[model samples]
Structures are given as structure tokens and as C-alpha cells.
Target chain A: MTGDAQTPALPLHLRAAILLRLLAIQGVWNYETMLGNGIAFAMEPALRRLPGGRQGEAYRTAMARHSGYFNAHPYLAAVAVGALIRAELDGVPAAQIDRFRTAAPGPLGSVGDRLIWAGWLPLCSSLALLAYGLGAGPLAVVLLFLLTYNFVHLGLRIWGLHAGWTQGLRVAQALANPLLRQGPAHVARATALVAGVALPVAAHALIGPGRVLLGSVLAAVAAGATLVTLLHGRFEGWRLATLALATFVLYTMVR
Target chain B: MGGDILFYVPLAVLGAVLGLDVVSFPQAMISRPIVASTLAGGLIGQPVRGLTMGVLLEFFALESLPFGASRYPEWGSAAVVGGSLFAAIPDGSAGAMSVAAFAALVTASIGSSSMVFLRRWNAIWARGQQRRIARGSGSAVVALQLAGLSADLIRGGVLTLVALVVFSPLNRAIVGTFSMSPVISRAVVVAVASAVGLAAIWKVVRTTAGARWWLAAGVGAGFIIAGTL
Candidate 1:
């Protein structure tokens, strides 16, 4: 990649240090500005070495500026770090850099929260629990979970850095990319699929044969009804109603 | 049997590290109850017990979407308390697991409230250092960051210690006092957990078109697979 010659670029060693520091970017989180101070602290190394020939004045200015209000999901903060440094080196005015900061965190946060918190963690945790329940050893379940999760977790940090540096502020558009969107959706679907299949078998294993047969028919019917209703876009109250019905049935049968 | 310092010290340290990891360090899902509790149980020579407790706690923990400024229960240290208590209970009865789980859930709720105080303390410290930080002193920023990390570390460690000292005994007593039949209690746990997991699935898939077909196919295939087995 060609480095822009308008200003001195961040050195490779310095970039490594910044990425390492980014891992602890919430160390100084406050209720007022969240990771604001931590972001400033993480950027301190890169800021100190900005090559401005200004006797460390550049470092002071950079620190004070980044210490303002900032909040974003930690994993997605890499994108901001990469772009922020690139823009600083490109001599993008402080006002413009500030504008980029304000614009980036919100959208990137939603994408990260949805992809990671809502989508990835639940699915991976489910798979791990399912594996554990199926007699997979504890170590195997933990390792499977860690590997499946980090594939995306580490991948995003590494990828975000490159994307933020090269794409600059336009990196927000990367969230809209179809390839990126499809991965989470696919995983979500796979999770639901495996879970749907696995739960009945698990119930059967846990319960007895006669109970399995009766429960399977009832569960299948209830699931089918619920699925149809959800697919038609009316899913809000159905979960509670279904649970209440299931409980009533179970209590009656047990009595 | 009470946890000796050998067990207690490392578990507290583990709680510190994992608890710090919740907000300050890697934020790897290891801070999760399933992983954290399992690790805690293994440290005390009860890996299976810890793992079982973790799986149960993970169900209730799933409802939490820890994003933005949301004040969600802290699970890492709390899970250690739960797992350790369950493992320490004399009998592995359904009542035992339920009591341990309840203790952990209460610890998590307390942990959530404590986080607000921690945040306020961090803010107070940050406010004290604002001028120096703005004055471009690298040491000031470094000091503040280190202070915050140290505070969170202590917060997690102390929380783990207190919950263990207090709730471990409470959990043991509750298990002794309660008298639900094992079969019924276990069945109820399984049923409620399955319902929660199902609801979580619905939240994930209700929006995705054609999800029902894939789910139906899964159910039919599952039944057939079971028959062969």
C-alpha cells in the first residue's frame, strides 16, 4: 500500500504498540465519557511519535483532544483508532478529525453490538453448552467456543485497523457490505437450525420414551404454530403464551 | 468444607482477572458465567460441578445484552461464587443446584449495583486529574489509567471474596432446609431453561425470512436421527 506523502506516516513498531494498547482502552472508563480517557491513553504512543518536529507539543495537543467524550464497543474501537491516526498524519484539521469521531462511533457501535453481542456470543455459547450436554469434554467445549469466537473477534480487530487506515472515514460503508452482513445472518440461521434439532433430542434423552413421544407431538405442533406466527411478523406475545401453555400442559400431565 | 486460602487466593485472583476482563481487558466472553464458573470449579478440583453450574447460569445471563451504558449484572466474579458454592455443597441434589444458582444470581445483581459506584469513583478520580491531563502530562494520563485498572481489579477481587464468605454458607443452609423432590425440581429446571433458550432462539430468528422452513426441516431430521440412534 502506498503511504500518503502529505505527512509522516505512523511507523510499523508504533502501530503495533497502539494495537496492543487498544486492548486495554477501557482501563480509564468513566461514567461521564466512558472510554474517552482510555482512548487518549492508547493513542499516547502514536501521538508522541507523530514526527511533527515540535518538541512534544504535538503529543500534548493530541492527548488533550482525544480525551474528550468518546464511547464505542471495544472491539470496534480499532476502526476508530486506525482512521484517527491516518487522518492525524494526513494533517486533516482537528475540526475534521473531531467530526469523524462524532460520526463513526454510533453506527459502528450498533453493527458491533448486533454482530458480536446479539449474534455471535449467544450462538457460540449455545453450541458449547450443547456440546457439553452431549458428553463432549469440558476442555473441548471451551476450546471450540474460544476458537469459533476468536476467528471473528481477532479477525475484526486486525481487519478493522487496515480498513480504517486505508478507507479513512468511509469505513462506515464497510458495515453495509453484503458480504459482512451475510456472515452474521448465516450464523444466526445455523444456530437456530442446530438448536431446533438438538433440543428435542436432548429432551428425549433427558425424559423417558413415553414422555418423548407425547412431548414431541405437542412441541412440534406448538413450534409449528409459533414459527408460522413469527414468520408472519407477529412474534411479540407468542413466546410467553407458548410457555404458559407448555407449563399448564406439563402440570396437568404430571398431576 | 470451607475453601482454604490456597483455593481462596487463586480463585480471588482469577475473579480479579476475569472481572477486570469484563470491562477493562480483553472482554473475551471468558468473563461469561459458563467459562468463568467452570474455571473456578476446576481450580477447586470440581470441574464438572462448575461446568454444570455454568451451563445453568448461562441461561439467565443470556437475557442480558451488555452494550453501551447499560447496567447489566456482573457475571464473572458472581459465577465463581455460584460454582464454588454448588461444588462445596455436601450433596449434589436439585435443591443444592437451585440454591447455589440463586446465590449467584443475587451476587450478580449486587455486582451490577457496585459497578455504578465504581464508575462514580472513576469519574471522581478523572475529575481530580483533568487539569493535569489537559496540561499534556503523559504521566498524569498513565497514572489515571493505572488507577482505574487497579480499582477495577480490587472491586472484582473483593466482590468475589465477600460473596464467597457470605453466600457460600447461605447456599449450604438453603440446600439443607429445602425439601423439593429431586426429580420434580430437576424437571422444572430443565423445562424453564429450555423455554428461555427457545425464547432466545425466537428473538434471533423471528426477523429472518424462511427461518421456519429451516427450523421445520431441523425438527423432522432430528426425529429421524433419533430413531436411528
Candidate 2:
């Protein structure tokens, strides 16, 4: 609320710099601070605008404070960076900024994880796989995934930056906006639908219909395994697949 | 051997870039198994083979969430190794897919461990510069970030090269000696992968209201399409 409506937006070049730095925001991720260092790295460019510049007391205090432990999904972290920059420029108190910083990561992390990681990513990936399963060329499938996924990826980054800046200390209003609130549920539903279409198509592709009986047996086995996994708790598919293949390899070796 | 060296060196470099994409930079998800493996396969003029390997690997990769600092398989470089190993085979030999998958899974484990090491190393570097960082030293922060990126690049390159060198010949040997029928061996791999992928998707689908109905409709539509095909 302290952010002045009269405060001009950051210079385009500085905003560009922060956006570029955000790309590598997880570069130095660690247990103690998670993405804290990366956040500082992304924020540094914008902090250069503080009263004394990088050499100024204001800049130093903001840099050191922002460098402390913080974690959020990489893409949405742009919102946090944008808001923090706005806060610094508006001269928000360090203690209040600290409170916002601590509170921001949990929502950002959860929302981004659910939306991007679980929903949109799988949906696009399934669509691409579905295309490939139906006999699309490899280049086509790859292009489909990259183009579709990045469309949202780039858009979200740009939107987060703009939203966080304009909202500034009142950025929670941005988080509460309908897009963030309702987007995840809708995307998750679409993901489910796409995944269902993909599964049988991919199976049919891999197991040609020429051997109807064999394909049926394999399909049944897959279904059973899927059912068992669903009934059980967490889906550790990678680990299970690894073990199954490793055992198969060993059997071949022994024989 | 010379021919392999020529192929693997470039593949290793590609792995480095894609692996870095997993976390360090522009996470366009090109690091996904489907793309990474296909690229590896393209390197040897066997893009379809790479695609096949990639599809199976992609199924397993779907289970990974890549949440904040969570330990998950580094699929990018590992997929490159798997796809290259599978493509290297002269023919669609029995057990070839299985061996390549096994190699990929193992390499993913290695990549996973290497990531942990890189994080620790990054921590050490950051901790050493903590005083400067707390003092608001921009130069020190930049140095740490650059150093972290470089180390991750190196980790990915070395991991890919080592996996290729060790698994390539081993893969050939296993494929050559394997006695399982081609149909059955391939069926097992395909079955496990699809099942895992389906189940992983179902987990998410079941949680959201109305999603299950959408899924059922999609499945029915898929079968109708398959039937016509």
C-alpha cells in the first residue's frame, strides 16, 4: 500500500536484466537457503536503483536482507522479485519486507507446483506424446511440446513481473486474482482428460495390433499394475521401473 | 572406437546443456526425456529409435515433481545416454530396449547423486562468501552464481560421458547374449512404462472433482479411435 502510484516503473533495461537473471534463479540452490541466493541475484539489478546505488546503505541493506533463506517455484518467483523491487523503491520498512518475504514463498511454491509442475506440464507432455503415439514425426512432437509449454512459460514470467510491479506491497491482491485462484483446478482437469486419451493411444502404438492376443495380455498386466499402484500410497514409478528393468537385465545376464 | 568417440563427445556436450536446463537456466523443458532422447537419436541418424526410447523414459519421468530442492532423477543427461545407447544398436535386437532403459535409470541415479553433490558444493561456496553477501557485495553474489552454473555444467558433462563409456559396450554385450523373445521383452518394458504413466496421471485426476469423468470419456474416445485405426 505504501507504493506510490506516481512511482514510475523500473527502466526497461533493468527489468530485462532481472528477467534474464530469473532464468538462472535456481543456479545456486542449496538446503540452507534454497533459492535465497538466486533471489538476491535476480533482485540485485533492480536494487541498483536504490538511493545510493549499489554503494548506498539502502542498496546494501536490501541486498543482504533479500539474500536470506527464501524458497518458491522458479517461474512464479518472478512475482516475489518484482514485488520486492517495488517495495525497495517505495521505501517499505525492512522488517515489514521481511514478513512479506517469509509469507510469500509458501503460496508461490504451492500454486506454481500445482499449476505448472503437476498440471500444465503433464497436459502439454501428454498432448505431445499423444501426437507421437498416433504416428506424428519426432520433430513435430518435440516442436509441439516446446512451443505449447513455453507459450505459457514465457507468458507467466512476463505477467508475474508486470503484476508484481504494479501491485507492489499490495501484491497479495495479485495472488488472489482469479487467474491464480482458479487456474490450477481447471488445468488439472484438462490434464486428466489429455492423459486418458494419451494412454491407450500410446499403448496401441507401441504394441501393434498384429499380435492381438499378446497385446491384450500386456495391456491387462499394465492395468493391473496401475491399479495396484493407485491403491498403494505414493507413485514411485521411476524406482519401480528401474528395479524391474534391472532385474530383467540380470536375468538375461545369468541365462 | 574412434567413431564412438566422435559421436559421444558431442552427445556429452548436448547433455551438459540440457542437464543445465533442468534447473540452472531457461527451463524450457527441452530437458524432458522425449526431447533429449530424440536429439540423441538424431545424432546417429536413428531418430525414431531415440523417440521410442524417449517415450518409455518419459513415462517414468512423469512421476518426478521437481519441487523445491526435492531429490528427483536428472532425466535430461540420463535420457541422452539411454537414447544414444539404444540407437547405437545395429538392429532391433531382443533386450536392447531393456538394456538401454536400465542404463538410463542407472545414469539417472548417478545424475541425482551428482546434483546433491553440486548443491553441497554450492552451499560451501556460498557459505564462504556469506560475509560478503551479507555486506551486500554484488560482485561476490555474481561470482557464486557463475561458479554454480559452471560446476553444474561440468557435473552434467562428466556424468553423461562416464555413463556412455561404461554402458555402451555393456549394453551391446547384454543385447547380444540375451535369450528372451523380442516381443515378450519389449512387451514388458512397454507395459511397465505405460502402466506407471497411466497411474501417475490417475493420481492427479482422482483428486479433482469431475476429472475422473473427463478421463473416462477420453479413454472411451481413445479406444474408439484405436478401434477404427
lDDT of 2 at B69: 79
Once fitted onto the true fold, the runs of candidate 2 whose alpha carbons sit more than 4 angstroms away are A208-224, A227-235, B1-6
* Cα misplacement distance, residue A35 of candidate 2 (Å): 0.8
DockQ of predicted candidate 2:
0.68
Q: What are the models' TM-scores?
A: 0.84, 0.95
Chain A TM-scores, candidates in order: 0.73, 0.92
Q: State what share of the real interface contacts each candidate retains.
A: 0.38, 0.68
Please give the distance, in angstroms, between residue A133's alpha carbon in candidate 2 and its true position after superposition: 1.1
lDDT of 1 by residue, A106-204 (tens): 877877887787778877776776676566666787788878887888788877776777766667766677755776677667766776665555444
Question: Which ten-residue region of model 1 chain A has the weakest summed lDDT?
Answer: A233-242
Task: Give the lDDT of residue B135 in candidate 1.
Answer: 78
Residue B83, model 1: lDDT of: 85
List where candidate 1 sits over 4 angstroms from the true fold: A1-12, A52-55, A198-255, B3-7, B212-229
- Model 1, B42-91: lDDT tens digits are 88788877877777777656556578788878888888888888777654
